[model samples]
Target: MTRSINEVRVVGLGKVGELVALLLSDSGFTVTAYDARTRSDLPFACKELDVRDGAALRSALTGADAVVSCLPYHLNLGVAEAAHDLGVHYFDLTEDVPTTNRVLELAGSGEARNVYAPQCGLAPGLIGIVGSWLAKQFDEIRSIELKVGALPRHPAGLLGYAFNWSAEGVVNEYLNDCEVLRSGRRQMVPAMTEQERVVIGGIELEASLTSGGLGTMCETYEGRVQRLDYKTMRYPGHFELMRFFFDELGLRDRRELAGEILVQAKPPVDDDVVYLHAAVEGHADATGERAYRKQYVRAYQPLTINGRHWRAISWTTAASAAAVVELVADGRLPQTGFIKQEDISFVDLLSTKNGALFGDLGKV
Candidate 1:
C-alpha cells in the first residue's frame, strides 16, 4: 500500500516561492503556501502567515514534512529556527554569510530534529555543486575560479543591467567584504575590486570580487587549493558606473538608498540572462608534468518552463531552489540537519524533474 504523503509548506509569495510551490505540488506532494500578507487562497489550505511568530509558524507546520523558505536572507534565520523546533526539514536560498552561519549553528545543534539547508540559490547553490564536481576530477586541485551573473537578456539602459533578482541582495554583495583564497591563503577582499573583462562565446562580460558568492567553498577547500574565489559577472562598463557611485559617492554605507536607487532606476525584466563560469587547474596523478589550464565562457540561452517563457536568469534562479525542495521531498537528499549546496551531487541534481534547467553542462 502507498503511504500517505505529508504536505510541504512553502513560505514567501515571491516569484521563486510560487515556482517552488507549483513544482512541488505537481510532484505529488501537497503544498501549502504561506506569506506575510493576509493568508488566503488556500488552494491547498495556503494561509497568510507571519513567519516570524514562532508559535504560529510551529502551529502552521503541524503534520508538514518539510518547509522551504523563499523569504529574503534577512528573515531566514527565524524560519530555520522554527523549522528546527517543529521537526520539519528546512531549506532556503540565502546567500548572506552571517545568516547562513546562524543556520549552520542551529543545524549543528543536536536539538535540530530536521534538516536546515541554506544557500540553495544559483551561485551558492549550483555553482558550488559544479565546482566541487570539477575539483574531484583532478588529482590535486591548485586553483578553482567561479563566476556567475543574472542580467537582462536585452539591455535598454546605459548600465545594461536589470533587477532580475533581489535588489537588496545585489546591493549587499557590493557593500560587503568578499572572502577569497589567494595563493593558498584565505583573505577578505574589498567588493568590486580586481575588475576584469572576459569574453564568453563572443559575449563580453565583466567580473569582479563580490561578497558571499563563494559560499562554503573557502571553508570546504581550505588549505587544499593554491587559489579559490568567486566573482559576480556583469556587462562591460557596469563596473565603472558602480565604482563611481559606490566609491566616489560613498553609497556603500548607504545600503537602503542604494537598494532604493537601484530598484527605482533599474526595473526587473522577464528577459534576462544567467551566466556561469568555472575553472580548475591541477595535475593528473600519473603525470607529474605541468598542468595549468582553465575553462572560461558565458552561458546565454532563453528558456521556458511551467507555461512561462522565463529567460535564463529567472529559470536558473528559481530552478536551483525548486530542485532542492523536490530532492528533499523525494528522499534523494537528507531530510534534516545542516546541508550544504555542494552536499547534493551534480548527477543527482541533474536527474530531478526540474533539473532540465542545467541541460547538458558539457565537459568542463
Candidate 2:
C-alpha cells in the first residue's frame, strides 16, 4: 500500500516559500518551515536551520513525507540529496537547466525511494501542463507555442517593468540558451534573440526566447510536433532594452553584476499581473483532415489569501509547487522516480485547491 503524504517540510522563507508553507498547512498537511534566518512572524511552525549543514538539514527533514525546496536554484541539490537519503519525496521550483539535469541524474540512480520533481513553477510548471493538454486535443500536432510573463500592473521607468520575482532568475533566463523543437527536431537557440510582438487583453507585449521555461516538453514532443517553442512575454520595448544591457554593455558575461543592477534599479512591485498563452495548431481528432488552432490565454492579478495580500508571481509560483505536492500526496502522481511536468494532467492540477487559481477547467 502506498502511504499518503501528510507531513511536509518547506525549505526557504522567502515570498514564495512563506506562501507554500501556509497553503500546505491550510490544505490539512502538517507543515514545518525551515530557513537560514529566524522568522517568528510566520503563522506556522518554522525552524532556523541552514540547508548547507547536511546534519541540520537531515535533522529538519526528519519524519517528513516530502520536502519542498523554495531556495534559490543553485541551493536545491543539497536539499534534494538530503531528501533522497531520508527516503522522502522532493520537489523544487528551480529553472536552471543544469540543476534539473543533476536532479534527474539523482532520481535515475535507483537510490531515491521517492519522486524528484524539478522546474515546478509558473512558466515551466503550469505552462508545460497547459501546453501538453492543448497538444493532446489534436489528432496530429503541427505547432505549439507557449508564452508567459509576470509584469508590473502599472509600468514605470524606461524599462517598462519591475522585479515581481527574483532578479537573478530574470537575468539568468535572459542570458541562457532556450530549447525548442523545430521541424520535429530539437534545437537550442540563444536567449532574447527571437523577438515577436503579441497582444493579450488589448495590451501589447513582446515575446522572446527565455531559458528553462519549456521544462521537458521539447523532448516529450520532439518527433510528434513540427514546430514547438516557448517564450517569455514582456511589455513593448523591454526586449530591446535587455539586449542593450546584455549585448551592447556586455552584461551577459557579468551576470552577477547585471543581477545586482536589476535588483537595485528595478524596485519590487506588489501589484503585478501574470499572463499565460498556449497556442496549439494541428488537425482536430474529430476531423483529422481539417486544420485547427486552439489558444488559451489567462491573466492573473494579486489576490488576498487568508487576510494577507500576495503578489501575482508569489501566489502563481507557490500555488504551482503546492498543487503538484498535493497531487503527489494524494497518489494522483507517480510514487517514485523523476517526474516531468507533462506527466501530470492539467485537469488533475486544476482540481487542487491551489491550482483553482488558474481558472475553470471546463473551458480547457
Candidate 3:
C-alpha cells in the first residue's frame, strides 16, 4: 500500500529546494527542509546534517513519509539508498544517468517499500511527458525531437548564458555522450555534434545534442519511433564559445575547475527563461494514411508565486518535482515501484496542486 504522505523532508536547500518546500507546505504537507549548513529564512522546519553520514541521513529520514533530494547529482545516490532503507518515498531532479540507473536498481530490488521517482524536474520531467503525450495522439510515430534551454532573458556577452543552475550538471551534460534512436535503433552520439538552428517566439537559437535531457525515452521508444533525439537550445554563438572554452582551452579534463571558472564568469541571474520544444511527426490514422506533425513549443519566464517572483528555472523545476510528489501522495501513481515520466498523464500533471504553479510557467 502507498503509505499516506504527511511529514515530508526536502534536502539540499539550494536554488530549487526552497520553493519546493514552500510549494509542498502550501499544498498542506508538513514540510521539513535540510542542508549541510543551517537555514532559518525558509517558512518550514529546518535542520542541518551531512547526508554522506549514514547515521545522520537515516535519523533525518526516519520520521518522514517522503524525501526529495535537490542535491547535486553526485550526492543523490547515497540519499536515495538511505530513503529506500528507511521505507520513504524518494524523488529528485537528477539528470545523471548512473544515479537514475542505481535508483531503478534499488526500486527493482523486490524489497522496496515505496515508489522511487527520479528525474522529476524539467527536461526529463515535463519535456519527456509532453513528448509522450504528443506521440500517443498519433497512430504511428516517425520522429520525436525534444529540446530545452534555460538562459537569461536579456543576454550580454559571447556565451549569452548564465549559471542560474548547477554548473556541474551543465558541464556533465556538455561532456557526456547522448543517447538517441536513429533509424529505429538506439545508439550513442557524441554531444555537441549535429548542430541545428531552432527558431521559437521569433527568436533564433542554435541547438545541439546535450546529454541526459531525453532521460530513458531512448529505451522506452526504441523500436516505436524512426528517430528520437534531444538537444539543448542556446544563442547562436554559445556553442562555439563553449567548445573553445572546454576543448580548445583543454579544460575538459578538469571538469570541476571548468565549472568553478564558468560560475565565476557568469553568475546566476534572476531574469531567466526556460525554453521548451517537443515535435512529434507521425501517421494521422491507424492505417498510416496521412502524415502529421505537432509541437509543444513555449518560452517560460519568471512568475509570481506567493507574491514573490521566481526565476523561470527555479519555479519550473521546483514545481515539477513537488507536483510529482503530490501525485504519489494522492495515489495517482503507483504506491511502490519505479515510475517513468512518460507514464505520467500530462493533463493530470497540469491539474495537480503544484502543477498549476508549473503550467502558469512561458513566452519571453
Candidate 4:
C-alpha cells in the first residue's frame, strides 16, 4: 500500500510560499523549505536551493513524499517534471493554462504512482471547489459564475489598486485570452472585457472578465452548463484605467517592464481584502423549485497566525494550498493521479487543518 504523505518539500519562500510551509509544519508534516536567497529564523528547516538547476532540485527532493512548487508559473513545469520523474506527488498554485496542460501530460490517467494537482490557490482553487459544490446541490445546473479579487480596502487614485500579489501574474491574466463556457460551448474571450457592475455587501464595485481564474472548469462543464465565467472584481474605474495603460499605451507586449513599473507605483499594502463570490443557477430538484440560485460570497480580512498578522490575500492563498496538501497527506483525497479543483470536496476542503481558515462551507 502507498504510504500517506508526511515529508514535504516546499520550493520558493515568498509571502504565500512561506505561509504554506508554516501551515504544513503546524499540521504535523515535516517540511523542508527552499528558496534562492538564504534566510534564517524560520521555525522549520529552511535552505537556499536554486530551483532553476534541475540537478540540484531533484537532489533536494530526494526523500520527500511530495513537493509543492511555490515558484512562479514559468518555473513550475520544470519542477513538476522533476517530481513526476521521482514519483513524488506534485502540487502548485499556477494559473497559467499552458503550464497546466504540460503538467497534465506529465501525469497520465487513473492509477498513477503519485498525485499531480495544480491551480490549487484562491480563485482557481477555492473558487472552483465552491462552484462545483454548489452545483451539486441542484438537479440541473444552468450556470456557474465565479468572481474574486484581492485589493486594498481603501480607494486611492485612478487605479485604486496595490500589487499585493505577483505583477507578472497579474499582467498575464490581463493580456491572456480567457476560456469560458457560453451557450453550452467552450469559448475564448478577451480579458478585461465584459465589464459589469457588481455589488457585494452593498459596496458597489465592477467586475471584468479575467483569464485563468476559471481554471479547467470550462472543459469540465462544457456541455452541461449554459454559462460559466470567472471575473475579477475591482473598484469601479479600475479596469478602464488598466485598459488605457496596457492597450492605449501599448504596454501589452512589454509585460515584464510594465509589471516592474506597476509594482513600483502601487507596491504592496498590509491591509488588503480578498473577495470571493460564487453563484450557481439551477433547479433545486426535478419537481421542486425549477429555477433557483445559490451563492457563496464573503470578504476575507487579514488574520493573525502564530502571533503574527498576515494579509488577507497571503493567508487565503496559502491556506488553500496547504489544505489541499493536508487532505492528500491525510488520505482524504486521491492518493494518485491528477486531481481537479472541481473534483475536490468543498466540505472536506473546509474541514482540513489549514483549510479551516476558509471558514465553514456553509449551507449549499
**Pairs that clash in candidate 1:** 39-48, 42-45, 42-46, 114-336, 114-337, 115-336, 115-337, 153-272
For residues 96-121, write the lDDT of model 4, one tens digit per residue: 99999988888884447889999999
TM-score of every model versus the real structure:
0.92, 0.97, 0.97, 0.97
lDDT of 4 at 113: 86
In candidate 4, position 38 carries an lDDT of 72
lDDT of 3 at 53: 95
lDDT agreement of model 1 with the native: 0.79
Error of 1 at 1 (Å): 12
Candidate 1: residue 172 lDDT (0-100): 90
Model 2 residue 119 lDDT? 84
Tens digit of per-residue lDDT, candidate 1, span 1-364? 2312357888887867777777777667788888878545434556778877888888888888888888888988888878777788887888899998998888888756787878888878888887887777788888998899788868877788988788899999987899999878889989898888877667788999899987888887888898998899898989889989888998988988988998889988876777888888988665565795546444756565556675576567667777777777667877667788866877788887777558653222
lDDT of 2 by residue, 1-364 (tens): 3438999999998979999999999988889999888788878898899888899999999899999999989899999999888889999998888888988888988756899999888878989999999988898999999999899989998898888788888998998889999899999989997789999888899999899998888988989999989899999999889899889998889988998898889888898988899999999968656889999898888888999999988998999999999899989999999999988899999899988877742131
Q: How close is candidate 4 to the true structure, as a TM-score?
A: 0.97
For candidate 4, which ten residues in a row score worst on lDDT?
355-364
**Candidate 3 or 1, higher TM-score:** 3
Where model 4 places Cα greater than 4 Å from the true spot, the runs are: 1-3, 109-111, 360-364
